[model samples]
Target: RKQRKEAPDDARIRRFEDRISEGKFYLSLSSTKNDPRLMQALRGRLNESAEALGKNVAKDSELRRDVYEKMKALERSLAKAKRMQQEEECFSSKKLHASIVSTESQLRSTRKQASYLTQLAAKTIPRGLHCLALRLSTEYFALNSSRRNIRNEPPKVDDDDDRLLFHYALFSDNVLAAAVVVNSTVTHAKDPWKHVFHVVTDGLNYGSMKMWFLSNPPGRARIDVANVEDLAWLNASYSPVLRQLTSRKTIDYYYYGTHDRGARADPNAKYRNPKYLSIMNHLRFYLPEIFPELDKILFLDDDVVVQKDLTPLWSVDLNGKVVGAVETCGEKFHRFDHYLNFSNPLIAKSFDPRACGWAFGMNVFDLREWRRQNITRIYHRWQELNEERLLWKLGTLPPGLLTFWNRSFALEKSWHVLGLGYDAKTSTRDIERAAVIHYNGNAKPWLEIGIAKFRSYWTKYVDYDQRYLRDCNVT
Candidate 1:
C-alpha cells in the first residue's frame, strides 16, 4: 500500500494503542505470548480497537470530557433504576393512606348526622307520656279538691316546718318527670316525712302534675304542686325572667330566629332548647320567693334521680355561701367564659374568664343567705344587661354562672355525677356511687334518645306498674 500522511489525532491514538499492546495500562490476555502468531493476531485486533475508539472517544484533548460523560451516563442509569424501585414500593402505601383519609371523613360526617338526629329525638315528647298527661289532667279537672283528697296534704307541710324540714324545690312542666323527682327523693330520703317538695309548674301542666303526685303519693314526702302563672307577684313587673319573657327581642330570638335555616345552621343549634324560654327553667332563680318560708332548700332538677340519702345535703353548712353545688370545672372547659360571651366588654370586665362553673342539677341554696346577699336582685341585674342577648343566648347557665359566681360553696363530686345524658363515656363507677345522677343534656331518660346504660338507672327508680302509668301505657 502507498504511504499516507497520518493526522496528529490518529498518531496519538496509535501511540496509546501501542503502549497498551506493550502491557502498559490496558489489559490483553494475548500480551504474555511473544510469538509471531500472537503478534499477528494482536495487530488485527488493535487495528479494529483503534477504529472503534475513533467512533466513540472524541478527538484530541477531549479525552477527560469523554470519560466524565460516560461516568455521568452510568450514574443516570443507576439513579433511574433506584427511582423505579421506590415508586413500586410506595404505590400501595399511598393508596392505603388515601383510602384511610376518605373513610375517616365519612365516619366524621356520619357521626355528626347521628348526633343531630339523637338530639332532635330527645326534644320530642313521646305519645305515652302525652296520653298520661291528658288522662291525669282529665281526672284532676273532673273532680273537686274536697273529693280528690290527694295524700301528703297541707297540715304536716305547714310554713312552720320549713326551717326544720329538708325542703326540695323542683320546677318542671313534665308531670312524670316531676313524679320521678319526688319518688326518687322520698325513696332515698333518710326520713321521708322530714322532706318537703315545692313543685312549681305551668298552667298547662298544673292539673296533671298535681294529680300524678296526688294519686301516687310519695309515702310521707309532702309534695305541694302549684301553678307558676298563678303566682300574681311573679309577673313581668317583679321577676326579671318574666320581664325578659315580655321583651320583643327575646321573643324574636327564641321564636323567629335560628329556627332551622339548614345549610346555614349552627352545629349547636339543637342545644338552644326552647324550654329555656319557659318560666320553669327560670323559676329556679326564684327559689327564695317560690317558698318564702323555707330557710334552706336543696334544689333538684326534674331530670335528676336521687341515688343516696339527700338528708345530709340539708345539714351541709354552706359557710355563709348562698349556693352549694358540685364544681363542674377543674382542668375541663366549664368556665365563666364558656357560658357568658367574653366578647362583651361588660362581661369581660365583670368576671374572670377561667372562673370555675358549677352544676345546677343538684344544688343546695341557703335561701336566708340568698335574701341577705340579694342574689335574686343581682341575677335580675345581669338578666337586664343581657336583655338584647349580648352576654349570652342560652338561658339557664349564663345568668346563673354570673349570679352565683363567687357565692357558691364547692361540694364533693360524689354528691352529683352528671353527663349521663349526652356523654356516653360518663364513668359507671361514678354513676353508681353518685348521691344524685343528673341527665343534664338533651338525652333525658324519658326520651327515646336516652343512652341505654344510663336509662336503666333512671327507669329502675320509676314504678311503671302504677295505676295511672299502666292506664296511659307509659313504659
Candidate 2:
C-alpha cells in the first residue's frame, strides 16, 4: 500500500518527534531556585494550544489564526526565556537547564513549522489561475494539429533571423502572468517587430501557455513557447541542479519534510520556503544552454512587468561583465551577508562578506561573455558544494549573488524597481519613473495576501475584464 501524503503543518513538525519530550511539561512545572519572582519568569507554557488544536486546525483561516497565536505566544516565551537566562544562577540546575535547552529547540521548530505552513499556502497555485489553465488546455486540445499555433512560423535560419533581435527569456508556470509579461513588453516597445520572446513552462502548463499566447498574440513581435521539462540540455549530467531535482533525497526533502536536525533547528524559518526546492526558480543558471544562439538576452521573472522599451539594455556596455542589472542593496536587505554563509571559509575567502547584491527578476545577460568565462561551471561548482546547504538556506538569490560575484554591471535604479509585493512605502514618483517593476516578495499580486497599494501596478497589465477571465471569476 502507498503511504498517504501528510499536510504541511503536521508533516514539517511531526518528523521532529525526537526533539519533543516530557521536558516541556517540566518547563511550566519547575520553580527557578526557590525565588517566586524568578520562577514567574521561567513559568513557560509550552505549546499547549497547538497540542489542543491537533488535527482540528485544518482550514486556511484557522491555520492563519493558529500561526498568529503561536507567534504571539512564542514572542512572550522568548521574552521569558531571555529574562531567565539573564538572571544570575537562575535555573542553573542540570535538569532545569536541559529543560530550557529542549524548550528553546522546540520553540525554534514551532517557528519553522509556522513559516513552512505560510510558504506552502503562498506558493500554492490559486484557484482562478488553475481554472484558467484547465480551460485553456481543454480549448487547445479541441483544435486540430494544424489549427494549434506554435509560432508565427518555424524560426528561419537566415541572416534576417540572425540579426540582433531583442531576445527575452521568461521561465514560468503561470500562463496568465506570462501572457501579461509578453503583452506589457509588446505594448511598451518602440519597435515591436525587432523583439522576440522565448517562454518556457512545465509540461503540465505547456498547452495552456501556448493557448493563451495563440488566442492573444502580441502584434508584430514573435513568441515561442517550449516545455521546460522537454529541454534536452537540462538532463542530469549537464546540470547539478537537474541531478538533484531527480534525486530521491531531494524529492523527499520537498515532498515529505527533512530529517536533518540542523535544517529543522534553523532559527531563520524562511529557509523552509518550498521555492528553494523548485527547479523553475533556479532555471536562470542554465540560460546559456536554453538559448545557445543568442549573444545577449534579457531574462524576466513572471512576477515582473516591463513598462518601457528594453532594446537599450542590449546596448548597455556590460564592460566585460556577464550580467547587467539594477543594484538591489539600496533598500538594505539584498546584501551578500544576508543570503550567504560568511562563516564558511570557502565562501568568505572568495567574495566580500559585506558586498551589495543585485536583483534577478529583470537582468541583461551577455551570453557570449557568460560562455567564454564558463560561468555555468562556476555556478555548478557552488551548487554541488551547497547540496547539504552548508553555504546558505534561501533559494536562488544566494547562488545568483555568487555566480556573478565580480562580473556584473549595475544599471540605473529607475530601470528596474523592486518591492511591489511586500513594500507599501515605495514612493509614487520613483515607481512612475521605473522602466520595469518587480513583485519580488511573497505577497504576489495574484493572491489575497498581495498588498492593495501595489496590486494596481501588476493588475493593470492583466486583462481581468476579458470574457474568459470573467467566466473563471479571475477578477
Per TM-score, the best of the predicted structures is 1
What is the TM-score of candidate 1?
0.77
Off by over 4 Å in 1: 1-111, 153-161, 255-267
lDDT of each: 0.77, 0.77
User: How many backbone collisions does model 1 have?
Assistant: 0
For candidate 2, the lDDT comes to 0.77
Regions of candidate 2 where Cα sits further than 4 Å from its true position: 1-117, 151-163, 255-269
The digit string of per-residue lDDT tens for model 2 on 191-217 reads 887788999898889888889888888
Please report the TM-score between candidate 2 and the true structure. 0.73
Candidate 2: worst-modelled 10 consecutive residues by lDDT: 14-23
* Residue lDDT tens for model 1, 1-475: 9999778865555554444344322123222232444344444444544444454554656454353343333334334434544565587589989999999999999998887687668767899999988999999999886856556644455557565678788888888888788887778787788788888888999889878876778887677888888888888888777877766656655655543433243456454466867887888888888878778888899999988898888778888999899998862678887788899899888899888888888999999999999998998998888776778876688888889878989999999998987889999999999999999888888988788888988888788898888887888
Top of the candidates by lDDT: 2
Model 2, residue 80: displacement in angstroms?
Answer: 33
Count clashes in each candidate, considering only residues at least 3 apart in sequence or on different chains: 0, 0
